[model samples]
Target: RAVLAAAGGVAAGGLTIGTAALLGGTGKGREPGGSPPEGEAAAAASEEAGTRAIADPVRRAGHLLRRAGFGGTPGDIAEFASLTPVEAADRLVDFEDMDNSGLEERIARANFNLTRLRGGDGRPGMASDMRAWWLTRMAYTARPLEERMTLIWHGLLTSELGKLGIPRTKFMLIQNELFRRMALPRYDDLLKAISRDPAMMVYLDTIQSSAAHPNENYARELMELFSMGVGNYTEQDVREAARAFTGWRLTAPPRVQLPEGASEAERRAAQDAAAEAYEPEFIIQPRLQDRGMKTFLGKTGPFGGDDIIDIIMSHDAPSRFIPVRLFREFVHANPGPETVAWLAEVWNGSGHDIREVVRAILKSAEFNSEAAYRAKIKSPVEFVVGAVRGLELETDFRATLRFWGPMGQTLFQPPNVAGWPGGPAWLASATLFARLNFLDAFLFPRGRPLRVEALLAREDAAGMVDEALRRLVDGVMSEGARAALVAHAESIRDPVERAATVAYLVLASPEYQLA
Candidate 1:
């Protein structure tokens, strides 16, 4: 009860800080001497408000780590803190230079059961494994930005296991690999590739589309959700794009030959095996394709899916739309028009290269500003993986797999075509409780010794509290919160228990809830 009371106090204090930060901004229209601001001075002040740099290196580095990827460890933050913002951004954004063989080896050693097991139910078990696989990568990947970009693409260009079914779950993994491989590709190229993705084809009913009956699901989502925001394109544009996207199909696996005396069970086994071994290839049937000239976004052509994607990429909306989304993901939710306009210019200049846009966002003063720090709430995945990465916890992520559903985020499953409604939605009361419960299960799993080696190096109560705060919350807690944590730590006699308790309190604090 005392622990819960102390934790609640820390949460209240942290909420106060977060709320202040969210509402706080530069005192625009006023001169520093308290005189009424002149026009140039006011403009300069607003500009400075948007582009001001974070002066503290530790906070800046911590902010970048939390936003760019999962939260970093103390060592990771310290290493990044030594570099300038531009240098730090470059290192993370240009992650192809990093050797991730160690992560690959770890994954190999973990040997995740990603495939269907013989004589066992497939989807349920494989789905759990898939979630664990991704959580492991997020926790341990050397190229954090690469995995982060993959996650962004997954949420944006979404396909779900609920629709794909047991036989086709492999397609989800294939799509995931595609996102990782082309994590920073040009926007047009990615659109083109995903347009032919098997999981997307099935999920959006693109495979069922044809010239005579062009399903508008993919076309509508592509413009309204993926590329451009709504009101930028018309229903007529959607119909036209759907017509162009017709005839999309995946190659079927060859029928398995059964023995002359084979039983029903044997036939079923052979079919399952063949389905498991099958690799889908995207193909377009010319007969089903609408070859007639159609108008799309004011351009008249015999447009196919690729042509439609190219035209969307060439449009003005995606220039603003894509960058705005990336900014929201990395910086904060509410971005000003001036900031959006500048990001759009960068997008246009770079020909919609994702790497360049991400690089600009990371290095931008706006991203490292006071407003950007702790301004956005962490998603469930971020909350879990951030804790694992921040605390340097070692696990295969199996035990915590069930917690994701309670937290309102399950891997390979998004609620709808628009993906997760992030930001404030992540902190709903139910999910908040789930998050706290998750800490309980994570910190003190059943029948396992508490793992606090990372925190145990600092033996004293104050030292332990500071260490938890430093790693979990970037060492930025109110004095009262710190004292409350220290008091809780001191009350516990066992060092391991003390370390675990402080860590739990810090993780439960509202400040750590925000990214």
Candidate 2:
């Protein structure tokens, strides 16, 4: 209860600070200050009208890590702090060069149960296993941006397990792997691929769509939520695109041939075995396709689903819309037209290559600006995964799976087609408690040993407090907050308890609440 009260106080204060940051209030990053730091003059000169470059290397690197990937550890921060802003951006954006075999090996050693896990009654455990698998990847992947971009695609190119039951849940992992593989591909190519994605076909009713009676769900979301924002396309466009996307289907499992007079249990086991063996692949039935010319987005053609995607990719709206969405994900909300226009130019110039656009955004003056730092709230996944990565926690990630739903952002289970509402919606009172409760479970697991030995190694109470703040919150806190944390720490007698208490307070602090 005391911990909850502290979290509440810090949360209220953090919200005020976050709200102020959003409403154009100045932060330490924005204080009328010294001439732009040594190497940042050119970058500062290029800043958009209202934005200023972050001059401090530590803060700049910290901001980049939180936005570009998940949050970084002290070693990660130290390594990035040594690089120039452009170098740092390159390191993260060009992450294909990084050796991630360690993470792969870790995953293999973990031996996650991606297949069926049966309890007493033979209920499938794939959903929980899938969630643990993804969270573990987010927490421990060597190429953080890979997982981050995978998450972006998952949320934007939304699908849900709630709709796809246990029998079909494996498709979600297939879709997830697709996102990771094509994490930084051309927008058109990704759209074309997702059009045939088995999970997407099922999620948006694309499998049910036919030439005679087309389902409009995928088409509407493709334009409104996925590619182009609302108002860029119309009902006519949706109908046409739906017709163009007809006949999409997944390969079916081989029929189970049960012996005559077999019990219901035997039949059920055989069916489950078949489902487990099935590997979904996209296929098109020519008879169900609408090969006739149809007008879409002001152009008439005998367009298939890929053709519809190609057209959307070529449209002016997606060039702007995709950049705006990426900017919101990596920088902040409410980006000005000039910034969007600049990003759209990168999008168009690179032939809708997402890697080029992400590179431009990461290296841009706007990304490192004071306006972008701590400008957005962390989603629950970010909150948990960032903590896990930042603290270097070691677990299979099974325990953390249950907390995601209560915190309102479950993997493969977005509430609807639009994905999580995000931003301020993540910090509702109930969800806030859920986050704190997650920290409680994470920091103090019942049977496991405490995970704050490094923190406890600090010489004294103040050192421990500062270490926690530094590791989790970029080492900067208001004097009052710092003093309060130190005082709280000093009062605790046991070294282990003292370290955990301080760590909890810092993690619960409003400063840590924001990315």
Candidate 3:
């Protein structure tokens, strides 16, 4: 259902990204931005723990969708509600195919997306523009679970060309290829793809890695960021692994203007010739490599790049780390511990099968339990993007890219290698202001199928706060929180004020921001 907009885009009065908010969501004025006291948090935890005592699939599906993929559309929730763990697993791939139907086309379109010189991020848009695309896709996707998995894997198996001063076109090509081909494949296959990627080579300094001047950057990340995680591998291991990845490089994207009726053989030959013939192409300089024995995660033997990947993947750490991450991502952080121990068993048993681990998590009592739903805070990326999708504000996603910039994320530009500290970091006063204001950007005052106020009216207002709470939260809100929202709405006389007040309360509420 690719509906091309006629000439001028969706009208201004209807659902749209509010572009003129001179007062953007910004600042770090949060009232002590950190996790709440244990006692209060634990009580809330217990209440959520209480919700899990029943068999509520819609609730469970919603719980899973919020963290697993993006936000759940009504249809997505219903679809999730109709699945068994195996059925859910089958559904995931089906959804992936559908989501990526126009993916290549969309990527092509994004290349031509008009932009108005957004600051100096090298990327366009105000915030992380891609996140906006991701949010809507998730909101619209039939397979929310797969989206979540892709995101988790992306963080672990990272890539970026801009960070390496590589050409942008090639970088985009690599990104599209990664998601299109390996996103849903086995984690092992995904690792192999990452190892060969031009973007990964540059971003991790692997291209500079050599037989003489060994760059340990990519090697360290494979152990620290990708697989075993921190403290499991040593600096010596990084050095050894760097040597293993010697000779990894890339040919830049082509600048060919093919002649008409080029033969298939001629065209392919041209491509191969282009790759092999390009001058000043990106290439691995292996003179710096240190060929030596490096004991990584207690595996000591002569190792090369493939040997390094084998050692890392065959170890206990990646399998364990994966489930713990999946648990952290799809469920709550403090997942009964026992739940993880069991899931880890399955993950290891299945050769670190991501879908297997995810299926296990989805079926576990812990996942369906109350404690898991509203356990974590939404990353700034999730909050702002979710706001745009929730309001169905479709436009050139540049607005979202712009909005995300101030909130502290730029597409392909993370704050550092460690990535954004998601939870309390997003709750900072300055960052929180930017997040809440993101919703205000979508609220239009006039036209058909209106904006914020119209959204409030269509929803049952008696259940307005409840609906907002459900859309924003993973679990039930406290009585006090509910009362507060209703009270705020009642205090307002104007419909616009009422709607905006309700929205503010919902977004400001503890439930909305937490994952």
Error of 2 at 66 (Å): 0.6
Estimated TM-score for each candidate: 0.91, 0.92, 0.73
Q: Point out the higher-scoring one by TM-score: 2 or 3.
A: 2
lDDT of 1 at 313: 88
The per-candidate count of clashes, in order, stands at: 0, 0, 29
> Higher-lDDT candidate among 2 and 3?
2
lDDT tens readout by residue for model 2, 60-158: 888889898888888899999999988998898888888988888988887666777342344337788778878888887768889999999999999
Expressed as tens digits, the lDDT of each residue in 45-147 for candidate 1 is 5566555667779888988998999989888999999999999999998888898888889888877867773436433466677778888998999889999
lDDT of 2 at 198: 85
How well does candidate 3 match the true structure in TM-score terms?
A: 0.73
Local accuracy by lDDT, each model: 0.83, 0.80, 0.57
Off by over 4 Å in 2: 1-50, 117-124, 447-449
User: Which structure is stronger by TM-score: 1 or 2?
Assistant: 2
lDDT of each residue in 336-407, candidate 3, tens digit only: 566667977997788777667777776666666545545566776567556544544444455555567667
Model 1: residues with Cα > 4 Å off, grouped in runs = 7-51, 117-124, 256-268, 447-449
Q: Rank the candidates by TM-score, best first.
A: 2, 1, 3
Whole-model alpha-carbon lDDT for candidate 1: 0.83
